[model samples]
Target: MILETGVVVAVESDGLWVETIQKSACEVCVAEKGCGQKFLSKLAGKTVSIRVLRNKRSSEEFTVGQSVTIGIPEDIIVMASLLVYLLPIFTAIGGAWLFSDSDWQAVGGAFGGLLLGGLLVNLHSVRKRDDVRFNPVLMEEQIQPNILNFQH
Candidate 1:
């Protein structure tokens, strides 16, 4: 599980609205210095919020303006990216090589494989869109006041 912190901006009977704080490392990477991402993050000022899963345990209760930390599975992100972008191209190349006959059959196989791969990738992504996990946690001593203004 990967842990990330956010501030609770709103409270509901079932869950809370946690505004995720965007960190500088997201844009400071040397490889992304000149990319469109840097410009976009700058324009947005680094915070986004959506409802989080309700805690089943009573100890996890959260109130408005409270700070919380959520645990998200890292594997989900990795698998999703791979499925969407790599699967199609890989299937196309592999199918083409395996079915090659110096004729149009090779072309047909390659196109079919690529199409199937892309379709599967998109379907998987949509199915797992709600898999993000959230939990409420107390802020550490020094950072409570700053979570709301840490945006850059």
Candidate 2:
């Protein structure tokens, strides 16, 4: 499981809306100062909002400001990435091979195959949008100093 820490922004009946900073590995690399990726990461916004499943037993105990860790399986991420990227590439190659006799025909076939592959991926994703395996779940809450304890 890959875990991430975020702050609960809102509490819903079925889940919590958590806001997390999106950090790239380059951010902490020793050579980050000279890496092009570091510059691109800066261009990308710092935060993202994700919905995490609320634990049924602790749902009522959660508050908006609470800090928590969310988790998703590593395999799910790998599978999603492959489906989005490799499918089109393989399909395009297959299409080109089918029309190999003519150069222009091969190019047109590859383009059509790429579009079809993308459409298939989109349809599959839409059908599985609510699959539990792809959803992130609340792992555990982090303890923070109670503001009520401070007296001024």
Candidate 3:
């Protein structure tokens, strides 16, 4: 499980809307001074809202401003990345191979295959939209320090 900490921004019947900072390792890397990733992160301000499925044990207990941890499975991330990135390349090669007789035909076939691969991926994502395996879920709440503890 990959876990991230976030603050609950809203409570809904089905889940909590959590807001987390969008951070990347590039921000803390020694080479950040010249990294294109750092520049892109700066261009994209660092906050994202995520809809997390409420924990079954505490589904109705969440409140806005509460700190919580959310988790997503590692396999889901890996599979999604593979489907989005490699599927097109593999399909394009297959397509070009199918039209190996002519260079122009191979090029056209490759483009068509890339498009078809992307479309298939999109369709698969839509079909799996509600699959629990791909959804992030609330894991645990963080305990906040009591402000009154410092009072005399």
What TM-score, computed on C-alpha atoms, does each candidate reach? 0.49, 0.68, 0.68
TM-score of 3: 0.68
Which runs in model 3 stand beyond 4 Å of their true positions?
A: 7-17, 24-44, 55-67, 141-152
Worst 10 residues of 2 by lDDT: 142-151
Candidate 2 residue-wise lDDT, 1-152, digit = tens: 87777787888777778888756355567987777765665778567789877656366667777777788788988998999999998889888888888999999989988998899899988777556677787675543432543448
lDDT of 1 by residue, 1-152 (tens): 55567877877665567888666456457867666666676788678785665544332455567677765556754765677789999999877887799658788889988998888887875675444332333333323443444547
Error of 1 at 58 (Å): 11
> Which pairs of residues clash in candidate 2, taking residues 3 or more apart in a chain or in different chains?
none
Top candidate (TM-score)? 3
Ranking of models by lDDT: 3, 2, 1
Give the per-residue lDDT digits (tens) of candidate 3, residues 125-146: 8887656787788775543323
lDDT of 1 at 150: 53
Please give the lDDT score for candidate 2: 0.76
- The TM-score, computed over Cα atoms with residue i paired to residue i, of candidate 1 is 0.49
How much does each candidate deviate from the true structure in C-alpha RMSD?
6.7, 4.3, 4.9
Which pairs clash inside model 3?
none
